[model samples]
Target: PGQVDFYARFSPSPLSMKQFLDFGSVNACEKTSFMFLRRELPVRLANIMKEISLLPDNLLRTPSVQLVQSWYIQSLQELLDFKDKSAEDAKTIYEFTDTVIRIRNRHNDVIPTMAQGVTEYKESFGVDPVTSQNVQYFLDRFYMSRISIRMLLNQHSLLFGGKGSPSYRKHIGSINPNCDVVEVIKDGYENARRLCDLYYVNSPELELEELNAVSPGQTIQVVYVPSHLYHMVFELFKNAMRAT
Candidate 1:
């Protein structure tokens, strides 16, 4: 028998892209209070912070998904808009859209196209990208999740599992799973943090689904006071999407 630790085996993605880097003065006491702190805000200086923290989870995942979907839909329509030979490619992309959309809608029917694409993507990852863990046993849910590309969309950003590369890529090549380890871990941790915050600001007793929200188009303002050379902060800002 052998003892294995997920953390010991992997270097977590550098937290250079945390969502809370914009918070106001992080105080000593505040740091002491929180767990797995991305950052902490002093109650006194918190008002000086600009980035809006409270947004729904589904909504959080939505903005990027919507952006990519817009891109995909446009590419698909270009294939469809008006065409000769393009018509068939358009039709193919259209069928992909239909099949994917159906997968999203419900499972009375999952995918409508050839089990061909299914096999195509399956072999791409080759059972498990990690190649160490029995992927099916480790992620039965992962396999099930891909049943709908709509469900997978941005949710699985890392390709085949390139640490941090987009999970939704049809094929993702990895040089070192160790090198790419941080992205997936950071992503999941960030997600859990966001979900916890969303749940907390809404209701202490409510379930996550209960906290789901309609888009509240509220204006968010910012005022920055920089004190240091933060390559990390710059990187985080670039990585963090301005919600569309």
Candidate 2:
């Protein structure tokens, strides 16, 4: 019941407007179709649980059956704890409040809705033959729910981070003139290389090529979020390094 409620509440909306940009080219057909699959799973699960909860109490009162109920409660509590930790961490990192708050608010909705349903499920059905038989099935759905949440959060992060990052860095640079753009990029690249080295301890040493599009007798200067750029480039480098 807890797993079912969690996935159902976190499921994708039918009217979701997610778009994929083709970073490599302008061809729409070449771009990947990225949409959260299994969005309707929650509704289906809610229905299944609704039916199962109607079973007789005699069938659900067994000692072994009660173990499943305890497991579901523990799982729900863990999920609630995770959401609380995320909220607290975001509060500690207020520099990116605007972007983080948006993600946090979405979580706030999901956490409560899932919590409410889990509470109701606990009250209605503690453990029964239907749930015991289907617990493994719903466990897989819970795993999928976590993965879906991660992908959704990543998409929102990239969007909000890009939107707010320029102003964020500018505000920082104004307070500290020593924050040089080229130097920052260089340091970011170095950090990424170190991370790659740590990850691939015995692999071939990875080399990153820095390219600049320069016109004759001109220098290029661009200002952006160093951390975000570092993450983007680091992911690319990590994949390339692994491919080798």
Candidate 3:
């Protein structure tokens, strides 16, 4: 989970107010919320089947749910080479709405369970010993991410609930007496200089094509985010001066 922290402070400058406003719905916020909800998926096999059995048969009409669920199932199938295909065998169609879907491990599949925060059932009842472990691990990670995403959405919803004015202003942390204005921070030059008090190299020397850190052996698993070499060097120097 990532913690939120950003601050900025400046003297209030008097400005006139505009006319009536029409703030359109923000799609970015909505997209972010959904992405989190689907982050982790394909919970335990038995657990998934159990929840599916309990779901309303009319659930397919919800396009949003179907969209994510289908993608999740396809992903799992591709990873596991699962040849099975059926609504009952669907590994990725599970999800929760206002009520979060969770799991609680318990012995015995035929105890006549009841509804709670989460419900469990055996979907892919049996799997070979070789693949069962990998399958379960994949679902576990998915489940954890799903919970994290939903919590983010819930937090965002609560923050904008019916209430008073919101505070968009931030508190800037740096006040480097040596730092001079150079254009509103592009990439990290200004922020790094403000936070650290120096620039390493000229912008002309920075290359956009570079790898940060790569995961070995797996070409597809390599990590890379195109960024400025100059910014990285400058930030490295700034980070070093903190103790000085």
Candidate 4:
């Protein structure tokens, strides 16, 4: 009954990069952001849970898959419990921030967990192209939502002193108005190179001469989340290294 009621009231809103940047300040906008996340997270989690539930029985039975489902269920329940609380009071906001932090920490293993599940499924039943495509689609959406959820949570937590204070100028929560793309790429390459070297005897060096040209002097800056760009670049580098 509670689940049904909660879903009825809150539908997930379309969150875009522009919208996130626009509200990336530590002012009255934060309250609106907090309230939006407070309402939106549970609905997103519920949708993820529903999609996971619809996966094939064999896949669902995988231990990692089960664990992921349990995490989602637990997170959803926690958010639902806090659903009606007003974000108006400092105490309530602080408590909610704590809850967000807890939930964020709990989902840290989500990527590897889902990957393990896919490995287990493939090992047992072999790959069915149609089924694989469906699973891939689900995973893509799931991770995208996870990214958005974490961004929202981190933005709120940063604004509310969950971590060190958000940057006073040019930063709204995690979004950096002048994020340097080349610097992020270098960071990603270094990280990926470190792992590659550890796993393989010969790791290819990343050549970023072109990127470095415009990197200095903040010549190429975008209104974006640096960590998100780093994640994408890291994966690309990792894949390229593996192929090399």
Candidate 5:
């Protein structure tokens, strides 16, 4: 009950793509960005921990789940430990940024870790359709939240952590205001194709078709994180390749 109340006190803020681009591009590594993350990430991390805790005991007991839970707990604690530190000092800000980067790197294997946990659960105790559906629903939300958190961390790190400049002119942090959809999709397909080729004797080719006709030279673009778009496209193509 106490844990539930603590979790309830911090509501995760909804961030739009525009907001991410605007704030990240303009405030990259600035005091505003530092303070915003300092205040925001702890809440988000805490909420994630709460959600993980609420998973059914059998699933939670899986080694991967337990490991992930520990990571979250440690990350949250580290954030809280730095919460009271002033972001005004340059050294302190640098240290805090380093901490955030470390935390982000620690979660690099989260998707595979969660997938392993699910596999373990399935091998141990078969899931009924209703239970499987419920688990899937939870996983969908969990992965979405994970993406959002990683976006926040990655944007900050790329913009403020001395990484190279944005690859495109319209990019702000990790988001491009005018992301070329076809280019991103092709990049994803290439990656997936490579992976498929490694595993199968015959890998399929990707043919691009323009579903919506544009003017002679106009290209479809949207504001998005290129890596996120790449990841989604890669997953789709990977599944399609498997089916083939």
Candidate 6:
């Protein structure tokens, strides 16, 4: 019920939102082997079915809308595929949840780049400044929609993916100055340097170790979103790492 409620809150349209709550409306309801299982099964399964049934309606929509719809379609397909094949074991469930998080991460990595590319294309080819500005209205709406999707996926990954889930790591760590901010910070630094080298031709040394470590008297753990913190720190590292 909680999961279904979350979906309702995150759903794009309040009018169609009830489609997620009403399991009886799911198409091909005859496919389930037992009537009881169909009725008693997790509401999440029904929600996935609902999403699968509705996504096709967006096919003729704008390119950005289509991209988001396609992603949801594929993500739900993966969930269904995993549910059908797994034995409901802990390991199997973990792997399925991991795959879902990976899908969300991939979208996070791709969509921003896509938004930027589209924006750049419009500016480069637009006839006039006003025209480019006008086009930005639609682009802004498109990206806002994508951002909402990401936020929901991120929340879902954390709430349901459990302790071992990568999404859970985002909110359990503390500042690196403590020497115990976990290995993600180390990897983040390396990736930041690599990115700087690729773009700036000269990479600067990331003296992360020299930064003030959290004192023992202070709190050892800081609760926050890992991706948000990492991105900000990584960008700062890139700028500081650059050679003057």
The most accurate candidate by lDDT is: 5
Q: What is the lDDT of residue 68 in candidate 3?
A: 39
Question: Total clashing residue pairs per candidate?
Answer: 10, 1, 11, 1, 0, 5
Better of 1 and 2 by lDDT: 2
TM-scores for all candidates: the values are: 0.18, 0.27, 0.22, 0.84, 0.88, 0.42
lDDT tens digits, residues 145-227, model 3?
44333333333333222221332111011111212112112345445545554343322322233232554332232111112
Selected candidate, larger TM-score, 1 vs 6? 6
Q: Which model is ahead, 5 or 6, in terms of TM-score?
A: 5
Full candidate order by lDDT, most accurate first: 5, 4, 6, 2, 3, 1
Global lDDT of each candidate: 0.28, 0.42, 0.30, 0.79, 0.81, 0.47
Per-residue lDDT over 1-244 for candidate 6, one digit per residue giving the tens place of the 0 to 100 score? 3434444343343212233223223341222212222122223333443443343232223365456446655654555454455343566555655765776775764456545545545544544667456446545655555544454444435544554445334332211222334445666788887887788776766454423365644434443445556766777676677644
lDDT of 1 by residue, 123-194 (tens): 454444443243223234323323222223211222211244353222222112122223333444355445
> So what's the TM-score on candidate 1?
0.18
Which candidate number would show the highest TM-score if scored against the true structure? 5
After superposition, the stretches of candidate 3 with alpha carbons farther than 4 Å from their true spots are 1-125, 163-244
Per-residue lDDT of model 2, residues 1-244, tens digit only: 6656655454344322223222212332201211121223234334334433453454335343344344334333333333323333544223332433343344434424433444455566676677655654554564445444434444434433444455544332112222344555566556666776788763445343445566443333443334445656667656666676
Per-candidate alpha-carbon RMSD to the true structure: 23.7, 14.8, 21.5, 3.2, 2.5, 11.5
Candidate order, TM-score descending: 5, 4, 6, 2, 3, 1
lDDT of 5 by residue, 1-244 (tens): 3543475478888888878776766555567777888778877877767777788899999999998888887877777776778877888888887888899999999989998998999899988999899889889988988988898888777777776554644577677788889999999998898989899967888888755465656777878878888988999999999999
Residue pairs with backbone atoms closer than 3 Å in model 2 (clashes): 8-42
lDDT of 4 by residue, 1-244 (tens): 3683556455678878777665664243545765777678887777667778789999999999999988888888887776788768778777777888888889999989999999999999998789999999998988887887788777776666546543544567778888978789999999999999899966886776533454454457788888899999999999999988
